[model samples]
Target chain A: MRYAMVIDTLKCVGCSDCVVACQTENDVPHGYCRDWVTESVIGTYPEVEIELRSERCNHCDNTPCVRTCPTAASHVIEGGIVLVDRDLCIGCGACIESCPYDARYRHPEWGTVDKCTFCVHRVHKGQDPACVSVCPTNCMYFGDIDDANSEVSKLIAVRKYKTLAPEAGTKPQIYYLI
Target chain B: MIPFQISGSEEVFISGRNIPHIDPHLTLWEFPISLYLFLGGLSAGILFFSAVVHLINKEDEFKGAAKWAPIVVPFALSIGLLALVYDLGNPFYSWRLYTTIRLESPMSWGAWVLLIVTPLSILWVMTYIRELFPVIKYENYKMPFLYKVEELAVKYKKYMALALLPLTIILGIYTGILLSAFNARPLWNNAILGPLFLVSGLSTAAATIILFAKSHHERQWFSKIDILLIVIEIGLIIHLIMGYYAGNEMQIEALDVLMNGEFTTMFFGLLVVLGLLVPLILEVFELAGFKVPVIIPAILILIGGLIFRILMVEAGQLSRILY
Candidate 1:
């Protein structure tokens, strides 16, 4: 089963409720983040188009980070959830350089590469990911993308969507519906 | 838990897994990685030249390089290893780098090469110590272990040189591969980097030998070799620039930094003109039987070689796709 997160950009108001919830649930240290919102202003002021994108690790099938890591500390699990084994990480920062999305960060306290795990621990208990549950608009969907009956797969089948850096050939699991 | 203010300029202090989505112009893998690349290339390049000289030149009339290559390569490699170790800073988890070998990882390939080459190069130098300095033989007494090591080195020099050739090539080219494997960095993803760094390594090693040559004939031979490698390096560099200019949008963005951005001075003035081109011209003149002193070009090439490595490392980090 390939788990994925599908985000509906049109429904998001950028209130950052999910961002706050993620922090509280993960107990992440300050001055670092596993997910972030990027703001972009396209076109001139009169005809301006503003976009807010929330991004985290894509959990790619062909990750440059996984390929370049000296140790196998960065690995993909059964559902294609990329996780860092902090016990094995040497904090060499090679994976930081290899990530095109700039998704991962060094944990301020532990000095190990850290990123979103899609709340895997909570998922095993049959709970929604922290960010998805906290999103007030209910714009984010998380489920097995491979399961045609899943909400995430259904949302992706009909929505006009896009993904970042397709040229990178990483085949990200995250999808953004515009 | 500071929220994103409407306007932004400062970095945020994120509380959890989330931060504002933006790729800051962050530079990763700094001084230690650069030092490792430069020293690794030099060490491997010197050993490669040493092996070639040992095979071709039967008479050891002027064998300073043959003796120095094995001794100096390992010394340079050890410093690079130290730099890498310090960069890691987590000795506890660093051992994992050796326990698992990922074939696709350039860093894994590099680690194994270093572990093998360090001792092998030392052995290569050991075989020749008696020839370089006969004092060990002239001394009245010698330790049995020391004598045994010396005998093994002399006995196995030919086989070791043959064995060391392929490994030396890997050591020289591995630095470029290491950088290029980071597909996120546009400037470093070029295939030309492998050959470019290899030629650069060879030229730098040639310059080093020229500096240390005890006889005029040895100096002239190494100088001639340097001229060839330098010329090839110029062509490869130009190819790199042209390839970038003709590449896709993000790739061109990387070139724009080296071409016209803040790095222009260091890229054009320091690395291109002074570091590489000046040395090339000086060596050309000397090759034509001009009266230029060997040390002048040798020193310039060495300085240029080091600066070239530093600029590549910094510039590649500067050229990020996300930023």
Candidate 2:
């Protein structure tokens, strides 16, 4: 029941619908975001190639955030969902420093570190993440990658995809197909 | 037509003019964390100096700092602990840190280590209470419990030394390992940080003793040790920088920040000159039969130790894979 996400880079248009949906669903603060878009442009003068990526917590198998957490506040739950027990969080920001992706942000009001939960609240209820559901281009895929017949598993089986910061060796759940 | 060649490379190819300015600043662990690292090392430094002086019994001057060392440990450590709690998002619930332990996490080991170190330091200090504070002397006839406790403490004093040396050493290295565990920051990812910080902590702690030393001989002895520690520290700093520079492009960029980026003035000027080298030169002069105020070099070393923590914290935060 390990959940994961696969984002199709070629299909995305940098519309940021996923960003808005994530914010509204999570009640993310005005200045902070649960997930955000990154734009990388290459080439000089008229010959230009641009890539836009939607980034968030990788929920890695070898999670540095969980390992670096002084309190067991950041823990991996049953479904490989990395969660922060806000009630227990001391908010030392060690997890923030340890993350290569810079995914987690200190919750200003909540006084704890916060990040994308993959809409775990919705997933348990048999629904898609707010970002995946609201993505206008249907570029975001969310499913149980462990299930051989799942759409995410099929996508991985069929296409060549890459995860962010592989050098980190975190084995990120999110995949990007360029 | 892009030159992008690898997957998950530590670079983003940008040939366009719209490359957003990378902020020269970013930090997650702020003032409190840096102070904790500094004070923690200082506490360990004091403990190490006191223990060594106690073992050697060569100079009564060092005995002065040994008298204060036990008392200083709880005082400085309490402040450090307070800073840690204050930095927490949930200070009230920080006891949850003790609920479980993760060996892989230096933070968890650090917490537990401090927890045990407090009581052990108190017990060690109890053994020296008669010598350190004659006003509170315990008569065997009047206070049998105090006499019994003192007897046991004196009896097991050698064991106490064994316990404290490793604990203080661990305490010193723990501060460095805490940051080194964060593999994301190339600046802190160096393996030499443990030794580097240990030397910094010891040298600074040595300076603290020399500051309070009443006799010239006592000041001279620790000053000699300080000169050696300072030299080792300089070597470690060079090694730390070279490790980053010799790394990949991302690592090289991180080293550039430490070398000549926004941290240039602080790293090279305050940390290198005023903090380390000045004190080293002065101490060398003092050691070579030259008369110089011992307090000046001692003050400089202490300031340098503090700046080392602040600059290390800031520079590591500034060097990141993403923002």
Candidate 3:
């Protein structure tokens, strides 16, 4: 199943609750984060416009990280979720350079790369990811996009959305609804 | 309405709570990686030229290039590999690199090539050990095993040269491909990086040979080759910059990092002028019977070669496709 995440820019308040939820759920190091909140302001004075986005790993279909990994430490599993096998990872940092989103980080403790796993542990237990469950505004939608009736698929189908760095040809799974 | 007017200029500001390495700049690869690339390229170039001289049966006339030069490859490669391992976050798990070969990965290709080439270089050196070390007689030292191995190596020396010819080229090109494979970095995404690095590697190797080749004829021969390689390197640099200038917004921004940003002075002053241009003129004049101290141009080229890799790694990391 091809899983996807759809985040609505209009609904997000840039509170960064998702970032905190991800850190707590995954036990990410204190100084590092798997997801982040971005605020962009455009134009001048009266014509100014603002956009807020909560971003994370796109879990790209054509994964450059996976393609460039020498030891096959980075791979895609069931549900199109990209994960790293830390044991196999030599911590070469090649994957970090390959990622346009800058999603992955070298775990200082494990000495291997780490990134958002979409809380696959919770997904396997038939529960939403911690960030999705903790998001007060309910701006983030996560589900199998291949299933036509899935919430993520339906939201993406109806909304005017864009993915980050589409020109990168990675076919990112995260859709940002504007 | 207020008396003062608000600026009508369009402005875009982005604020992200991204982590350190991912946000302000990519500090993932550091000086170790730069040194690794430089040394790897140097080793490749030495082996390439040495193999070519051997294959052409010029070993008698160009003994420095064919024999003495290759002895440095093993040592250079060892040091480069050490730098690579030192840069790794989990050095213990580095052995996993050989468990499988991912054909699409330039890194995998490099790891495998290094594994094979390192041993091949040692074998090549072993064949010439007797000549290199005249004082140490294997029979007197009771190392008949080494003597036998050397005899076999000499017998298969031509075959080794044939094998090394293509492998060295791959290793040289692989140094640049390692960076260029990352599409995330605009400055490294260009295809010209492969050939540019290969030529730079060859030029550096020629300079290195010019430094220690005892024969005046050998020094002059390498000096002439370095001059040609330098010209080609300049041409490649021009095309690389021109390509970036004519590219999309991201590429133009990458070009700006080299031309008008933090690396501008180092790129133009150190690498272009002192590293390449100065050495080019010195070598040219030396060829015209001028008494140019060979060490000056040779040392400059070596330093320039190293600086080029450092600047590329550092500047490429800064020129991301997205902020």
**Best candidate per DockQ, number?**
3
Candidate structures ordered by lDDT, highest first: 3, 2, 1
Model 2 C-alpha lDDT per residue in residues A2-65, reported as the tens digit of each score: 8899999889888888878988899987666677776666554477677778878988988989
Return the interface RMSD of model 2.
5.9
Which pairs in model 2 have colliding backbones? Answer: A90-B89
lDDT of 1: 0.80
* Candidate 1 Cα outliers beyond 4 Å, as residue runs: B1-23, B59-62, B130-144
lDDT by residue for model 1 (A31-135), tens:
566676665555556876766667788988888888888899899988898888998888887888899888777775677888899999988887988999988
lDDT of 2 at A131: 94
Candidate 2 reaches a DockQ of 0.46
Error of 3 at B62 (Å): 1.0
When sorted by TM-score, best at the front, the candidate numbers are 3, 1, 2
Q: Give the alpha carbon lDDT tens digit for every residue of B1-323 in model 1.
A: 34222222222322234333233444656787888888888888888888877887733644757765456777788898888887773655777888989888899988988889998877877776677777666246645577777788778888888877999899899989888888998999999998898888888888888877778888888888888898899999999999998998778878877888878898789777877788778878877888887788788887878888888888887786642
How good is the docking of model 3, by CAPRI class? medium
- Using lDDT, give the best candidate's number: 3
TM-scores for all predictions: 0.92, 0.91, 0.96
lDDT of 3: 0.90
TM-score of 3: 0.96
Model 3 ranges with Cα > 4 A deviation: B1-18, B137-144
Candidate 3 clashes between residue pairs 3 or more apart in a chain or in different chains: none
Task: Report the C-alpha lDDT of model 3 over A1-178, residue by residue, as the tens digit.
Answer: 8989999999998888898889889999877888887766666578878778888899999999999999999999998999999989999999999999889999998889999999999999999988889989999999999999999999988999999999999999999999
Clashes of 2: 1
